[model samples]
Target chain A: MSPSIMTKGAIDCDIHPSVPNIEALLPYFNDHWRDTISQRGVHDLQTIAYPKNAPLTARPDWRPKLGMPAADANTISTQALDTFQTSIAICNCLYGVQLLMSEDLAAAFASAVNDWMIAELLNKDPRLRASIVIPTQNSEMAVAEIERVASDPRFVSILMLVMDEKPLGRRSYWPIYAAAQRHNMPICVHAGSAYKHPVTSVGWPSYYAEDYASQAPAFHNMVSSFICEGVFSEYPDLKVVLAESGFSWLPAHLWRLTKFWRGLRAEIPWVDRTPTEIARDHIRLTLQPVDAPPTSEQLERLMDHMGSDEMIIFSTDYPHWQFDGVDVIPDGISKELATKIMVENPKNTYPRLQ
Target chain B: MNIQLMDRVATDQKIKLAIADCDIHPAPKSVPVEIYPYLSKRWQDYMETYGIIYRQGFPTGPAFPKGQPNAARRDAYPPGGGKPGSDLDFMRSQHLDANNVQLGILNPLSCGQGVQNQDFSAVYCNAVNHWQIAEWTSKESRLKASLMVPYEDPSASVKEIDLWGGDSNFAQILLLSRTAEPLGQRKYWPIFEAACRANLPVAVHAFGYGGAPVTGGGWPSFYIEEMVGHAENTQSLLTSMVFEGVFERFPTLKLILVEAGFAWLPALSWRLDKLWNRMRAEIPHVTRPPSELIRQHVWLTTQPMEEPEPREHLLDTIEWIGWEKLLFATDYPHWDFDEPSRALPIRVGKEQKEAFFLKNALELYNLN
Candidate 1:
C-alpha cells in the first residue's frame, strides 16, 4: 500500500541520451559530415533547449565529472534502468538537430544522432528503445529519415519538438505523419522547441523558469492543433506520446477543450467524435515531472480527473531532476495505478513494444 | 401531475445564495467607436483616420475561430440585433435578474488594453471606463464597473486609476492577464501602488488583445488551443508577480484572476513554492514563501470550473485554494457561461456556497 513500493519491471517511456558534442557523433557520420563538422567548426550546437548546466537537465548525482551527464550507456543503465528496475527505457535524445537552419545539416545531424543512439545506447542494452529524431524543417527529408529507421525495431517512434516551423497538424507535416503511421511509429512530441518562434505568444520570456513553465502550453497547443486539423481522424492509427509534458494538466485541458468544441464543432465538422474521445484514443502522456500536488491524496484527485489510467505511461525523465532520488514514482499513486502507468499503459500505447 | 407538483416543490425549497458575479463582460453596443464621444476632437480624428494598433501583425480579431458568431451564445443575442453583452436590458433579464445576482462586476475586454500607442491606449481606456459607468452601472444599481487603465504606461495608468479609483461605482482596476510585460515587472508597480492607495483590488480577466500569443510560445494553431491557453499566461504572470516581490512592495494590493479556472492554482502554487525553496537566492527580494503571498494577495473566479472526473477532486482543490479566495463568475453572454443556480456542486453546504458565490468577492471589494 505504500506509495514508494516500486512497480518492478516498469517501462520508462522517456530517457534522454545526451549527445556529448558534435565530435562525439563523428564516428556514426559519413566522411562528408565529419569533414563538414570540422570545416564549419560546428562545436556543440547544443542550445538552451535543454541547457547543459540546468539543475533540471541532470541530477547532481547523475552528473559525470566530464562530458555530458548521460553520455555513457553505463551511466544511464546504472542511474535509470538498474535503479528503477526498468524493463524498457525509450531513449529520446533532445539535441539541437532540429534547431539547425540548413536542411542538409539538420538531416545529417538527425541521422548521426539516431545512429549514435543505436550504437551507444540501444546496442548496449536490449531493453532500450528509441524514438527516431527527424528533420522537421523538411518534411520529405524527415520522411526519408523515418523510412531509413523504420526497419529498426528498437526505434519505436518518431521524435519531434513541440514548437516546430509550423503546427504539426498542418498538411505540410502530413508526410512525416503518413510515414509514421505506415511504420506503426507513434509521433513523440517532446517538451523542448526548435525555437522557430518566441517561447511565449507575447515574446521571449525573461527567465528559464518562464521557458520551463511554457512547455505545458506548448503541448496543449500542439494537442489542439493535432485534434482540430483532423490529424487523428486522418491517420486513425497514429498515436502521440507527449514526453516530459506533465500529466496533471490533461484533465482540465480536455474538459475545457471539450466544452469549447461542443459549441465550436461546426467549425471543424471533420472532427466527428468529441475532442476528449479523440485525445483519449490517440494521446499518451509521460508521468515523470507529474506536476501534481505535494501529497499522494492530491495526486489521486488529479488522476481521478484524468478519467482513465490508460493515458499515463511511466517515465523517469532520466538525467533530469524531476523527482527526488528514489521517488521515481511520486507519492499519492496507488500500487495498481503505478503498475498501469509503468507497465500496462506503455505497452498499450507503443504498438512496437507489444 | 403528482411528479410535476413534487418537482415544483423541490425547486421552491432549494436555497439561493446572494450571488456576486465577479466577471460580467459587457460589450460595446456597436463597435470601438462607442468610446469616441469621450475622446478629444483631435484624437477622434486620429481614431477615424487610423485604427488602434496592436503589437502583433495578426488581423484584428480573436486568434481562433469561434463556434458562434462573436463567440457568444445563440440565445444571448438581443432581439433588436446587437452584440450579446451590448444589450443591458437583455443581460439583466437573461443573467442578473434571472439569477438573482446582488452585484455584477463589468469587465469590458474590448477596451484595448494592449495598444502599442500609449496615449491612444490611455484615452481609449478612459473612455471605456466612462462608457461602463454611463451605459451599464448607472442604469443598473446591482452592477459595478472595473476602472480601465492602459497598463503599459504606468504614470498614465496611475492617473486613470486616481481619476476613477475613488468612485464607489467601480469596485476594482481591470487588467488583462496577457500584458506586454509580466504584470510583476517594476514598470507596472506604479499602477499596483495606485490601486493600493485607492483601496481597489486589481482584477485580471483571462485573455486580452495583447499582440502576444496567449501561451508562452507563439500563437496557437487552433481556437481550441487558444481557448485552453489562458492558464499558461496566467501562471507566468502569477509567478512573475510573486517572484518579483510585487506583493512585498504593495502589501494591500489584491488580485482577482478571472475565467482562468482554479484547478491549476494548487499545482502552480506548489511548483512555485518548490522552486522558490531551492532558488530563493536568485530572487532575494521575495521575502515570504511564494504560496504564502498567493494565499494573501490572490483570488480566483470560478467559471470554466474544472470538471475533474470524480468531481470531488474539484472540492479538494477548492480546499487547497482556501474557500475565502474563490469568487463566483458566470462569464455572461459567452457560450460557456455558468448558470449561478447550477454552477456550484449540489453537495456544497449553504455557508460554503454563500462564501464562494458572494461573501468572498464582497470582502475583497469591501462591499460589506
Candidate 2:
C-alpha cells in the first residue's frame, strides 16, 4: 500500500466515532430519559443507516476483534488520527438520534450524545472537534440544543441527515440555520436519512445498494431546496458541507439549475445571483468519497469544471471504508490540488479552525 | 439569461449545422381526436366518458407547474395560439427547417402509457403510434416516429411493435424509464424480445405518469426536485437492467435514454462495476462487467446536456460516455430545449461535433 498522504498538519474533516449502544449513553442522559429508555427496553438504538457489519461500514484492517469499529477515541486515534498523521479531526457521530419519534427524548439523546463526545472523545483529544447532533423532529428543540452547545468551541458544526422529514430549507428549519449562522458554525449535511420519508420520491428501494445510490438524489434535492428557498441568501455567512455525498454530480446540477433559474427567475426574483455563484459561495463537499472518474486526468477535469478549488475539503471518512488504505484521496489530482483539498481548503471553509 | 439567448441567436444564424434531433414531442392540435379513427368504437366511447385514468393519484398534467404554457417555449406556439408542436407549418418555420434538422425523431410522451386500464393503455398507445406516422411523419418526410407500446401488457406491446416495427417511418420502440417495474424484469422481457426481433432500438424517455413517485422514495416537494429526479430514476432503471441480466439475455437490444443527463454515467458505471465485482455471486447471469454492457448497448440523448464547470468537463464526460453513444436531442417546443448551435461546449473538436450533432444518431437509427 502507498504511504499515508497525511502531511503533519492535515485536517481529517469526517471521522465517525461510533456509539456502540444506547447503554453507553445513559450516564450522560438525565434520569427521566434513562428511565424512559429502560421502560421502553431500548437496548441498542444503533441505527441501521450504516449497517454495523457492512464491509463498507468498517474496513477489514480497521475492524476490531473485541468491539465495534471506532467505538472509542483510542480506536479512532490509532486508525484515523495517527495513521493519517492528522493534526485535527472532526468527529461526526451518525447514530439513530434523528430516528426517535418523541421530540423531548430525541433532544435529550442528542444532548447526551454531544456530551459523551466531549467527555470520551473531544476532551481526551485536544486536536479533535465535533458536530452538534440536533433533534430535527422539532426545530425549536433543535435550536435549543444548538444554543446549549454554541458556547463550546469544540463543537465546530451542526450535523444533519440529507433526507429529513422535510426539506431542510423550509422556513420551519430556518431557526437552526439562524442559530448556526449566529454562532458561525457550518452545517454538515451527512449522507444518511431519518427514514421519515422513503429515500426516493417514488417509494422504498429494494436493496442496500439502491438505498446507498439514492443518497445522491437526496443531496441534489437538498441543495436545490437550500438554494431555491433562499437559505444561503438569508444566512449569508453560513457554509453547508455535504459530507460523504459524492462531488461528481455538482457541476451538472449547477448547470441545470442555472439554466432553469434563468427561465424561472421571475417566479423566484429573490434569487438575484446565478445559482452557480450562490452554490459556490455556500456549498462545500468532502473528498474521501470523491465520486469522480477513476482517472487522474478526469479528476483534474472535474475540478476544473467545479470552477473553484475552495469547494472541496479533505476527509478520510475514517472507519467507513470508501477507499483503500492511503488511497483516501482519489487518483487524478496533482500534489498541489491534493494539498489544497487536505489543508488549505478545510482551513478556509471552517473559520473555527483559523 | 437574455444576453445568453441573444448571443445564441446570433451564433445560430451563422452556424448551419445539419443535426438529427432525437427527441421532438408532437402533441395533438387539440384533444387527441386524431387517434380516434385508430381506436376501437368501445375504446373511443371509453375515452369520451372516463377520459384517461392515469395510474398516478395526482392530476394528469405535469407534477410541477410549468414556467411556459404547455411547458413549451412562448415562440413555439402556433399562430392560432394552439399547443406548440401541434402545427407542423409553425414547427417547420420555428424549429425543424429553422434549425436545418436533417431528420427529427418524434417521441410522444402524452400517450396514456400510465393509464390504470390496461386495454385503454394498449389502445391509446396503438392509436398514438398510427397517429404519429399519419399526422407527423407522413406529413413531413424529415420527421420519423417512435413505435409506442402499452408497456404494462408485454403481449399488447409486442402486437403494436409487429404492426409498425417493419415500417420505415417508425424508427424505434418507445418506453418510459418509470414503468410498473424496472424495464429489466422478466415481465418486460417480451417487449425487449419483440424490439430485438423487429431490429428496433428501445428509446426510453424520462417522464411517465406512473403512480409511483419519479424517485423510489416518494413524491418530491418542488419542481426542481422532480426535474432533477430524472437522473436517479434513470440510474435505477439502468441498474435494474444491468443487474437483472436483461442485457445478457437480450444482447441485441439497444437502449436510448432521453431527457436524462449523461454526466452521471461515468461515476454510475464505475460504482456499479465496483459493486458487481464484489457482489458477483448475487447475479451470476451477468457475464461481463456492467460498464461493458452500458458501453455496448446504451445510448444517451443530450437534451438537458450536462454543463460541467470549467466547461471542458463536459468534454471529459462525453469522452467517458463515449462520443459515439451520445445522440443530440432538442426536446423541441419544451422550455428547456437546447439550440443545436449552442448545445455543445465550444471546446468540442469538429469530428466530435459532427458525431454528436448528426453522424452518431444517423448510424444508430440506420437513417443512412
Candidate 3:
C-alpha cells in the first residue's frame, strides 16, 4: 500500500532497467563488433558496481525466475511505475558498457546500449525517459555519441559514473560538457565506479558494504572538483545530478567546501561564488538512501541544512533494495515538500520532462 | 568597596574558566637547524644532504597544495618573521595569553612523517619529539606534546610510543589521517596496542602522505579537495578500524580525530550500522552496532568546523553523535583556524559549553 499522503503521477527520477546480458545488446551492434565480441568470447561486460549475487542488486520480489531482474519493461512498469503511481520513470541502465578498456570498443558498446534501451524499454512505456551513456575513456567519441543521440526527446539526460579514470570536471571532459549544455541535458552522475582505483582514500575496503557506502564521499569529491575547476563558470548552463548518491553527508561536505573556497578563492579565480551557492544553482541529487535518522521528524531536521528545496528530485531507485516494499518516500517529508520533490523539482531539473 | 568585591568575583570566574586547546600545531623555528640538536651527526648530515624523499608528483611542493601560504592565517605569522607556529613567545602572546588557553597540546606537523625513507622517518620522528620537549612543552608548562611517531613503519611507531612511555609532558600519541595503508590493517595493529599500553589515546590529525590517492577514485582536479578531502580518509579509517576489530582487539584504546570534522559522523555511523546489521556474517568479529562502538571509542576535535546553514542544524547532528564526544580545537596558525569564542554557531548552554571547551580535552588527556 502507498502512503496515505502519496502524490500520484509523480516523476521517478531514477530506476534501473536491467540489460539481461551481452546478448540483449548484440542486435543493436554492427556486425564487425558483433562478430569480434562473439569470437573473443566476451560474454559479460559487467562491473563490480552491483554484483549480481549481491542482495542489493535486486529486491527479491522484483527478480524473475528466469532472467535478470527488471529486464522486462512491463515488470518495471508494473512494479515501479504502476505500484508507486509514477507517471514518468527515467531508466538509468547500469550495464557497465563504459568499463571496457579499449576506447573504440567502449564507444561501440555505449552506442549499442543506448540503441537497445530505446527499442527495448523506452518503446514500451510512454512515461519512460533515459540518459545517454558515454565512454568517458575518449571524450571526443563520448561527444559524438551524445550528438548522435541528442535528437531524441526521450533521452532526457546524460549518464556518467561518480568514479572513473579522473574527476569529471577535468579539462579533457569539457567537450562532453559543452555537448550536454548544447542539448539542454543534465549530466546524471550515478553511484557506480569503474573501479580503476581503490574504493576509499586509504586503500581497498574488504566488504561490499564499505564499498557501497564509499559512494557518498566519492560524490562529495566530484562536487568539489566541479566547483573548483570552474565547470559551472565555463559552461554556465551545465547541470549535474547525483543519482543514488546519499545526501545526508552533503550539508557538512558543502559547509567544509564553502569554507575552504572562501579562504582559497584566489587559487581557483574562476570559482567566482562560494561552493554552496554554485552547488545550489548547478547541482542536484536524487532522493534515495535518505540516510537520515529513522524518524521523518528527524529527517526534516537534517534536511533543513540542505538550504534549498529544489535540489532534491524524487526517486525510488527500484530493484536496488534501498528500502523495503512500497516505502518509496521516507517518513517525515511534509506533504508540501513531497510535492516539490516528486513533481515540481524533477520537472524543473529536466526541462524535457516539462 | 561593595562594587569592587563583585567585580573581583567576576574576574575570578573568568580566570577560573579552563580552556584546554586540543589541536595546536607548532612549527620548528628552522627546519633542519632546530632539529639538529636532537639528531646525531650522521643523521644530521643525511637530513641536510638528502632533505625529504618524495615522489616526482610532489618532489618540491605539496602534491595536494594547501590553500594559503604555509596553510596559515596572515596574522598568525610571528612579528619576528618566522612561520605562524614556529616562535614560542609569539604563539603564547598571540594565542594562549590572548585567548586564555591554559592547556595547549602541540601537534608539530613537520616531523618528517612523509619522508619516504622509513629509517629517516624513525630518526626524524625521534628528533621531532625531542624538539617538542625542548622547544614547546618543556619551556611552557601549560603546553603539552603529542608523542610523535613514524607511523608508516609499525615497529618504529611502537618504538617511539615506548620511548615517550607516557611522559607527563606528552598527553597523547600523534598519528595522521592519511597513511601508507588504512590504520586498522593488521600491519598497524601494533601501534594501537602500544598506545593503549602506554596509557595514551591516539590523536589522528588531518594530513599526511598516505602513498595512495587522497580520494578513493583518484586525484581530484583542485586544491580545495585537499582541505576537506582527508575527512573522507577519516571516514574510511573509522570504518576500517571498527570493521577490522581493532577496537575490539584493544578495548581501552581511544582515538582523538583532530581537525577531522564531526558533523559527518552521525551520517557515517548510520551507514555503517546499516551494513553491520546486514553483513555481520561476513565479519563475525564486529559484535555490536557501529554507532555504539563509535560513541564509545571515538572523540572528535572541532576545527575548521562545519558550518551548516540556519546553524541550529548543527545541534541536531551533535545530539546524534553525543555532545560529550566533542573536544573544541583551534587549529591555530592555519588559514581556516576557528576561534574558541565564536567557533560554534548554535547556542550551547553554560554547563555544556564548559565541557566543550575545557573539561572534555582535560578528561580525555587524563590531565584533570
lDDT winner among the candidates? 3
Computed on C-alpha atoms, the DockQ of candidate 1 is 0.43
Q: Candidate 2: where are CA atoms >4 Å away?
A: A1-5, A101-105, B1-15, B55-60, B153-159, B180-187, B212-221, B277-287, B308-310, B345-348
TM for every model, in the order presented, reads: 0.93, 0.92, 0.95
lDDT of 1 at B174: 87
lDDT, residue A83, model 2: 81
Identify the CAPRI category of the predicted complex in candidate 1: acceptable
Q: How many residue pairs clash in each candidate?
A: 8, 11, 1
TM-score of chain A of each: 0.97, 0.97, 0.98
Candidate 3 per-residue lDDT, tens place, A177-217, comes to 99999999899999988878887888887777778878888
Give a tens-digit lDDT track for model 2, residues B9-39. 5665675889999999998876546778888
> Which has the greatest TM-score?
3
RMSD for all candidates, in order, please. Answer: 3.4, 3.4, 3.8
Give the higher-TM-score candidate: 1 or 3. 3
Interface root-mean-square deviation (Å) of every model = 2.5, 2.9, 1.4
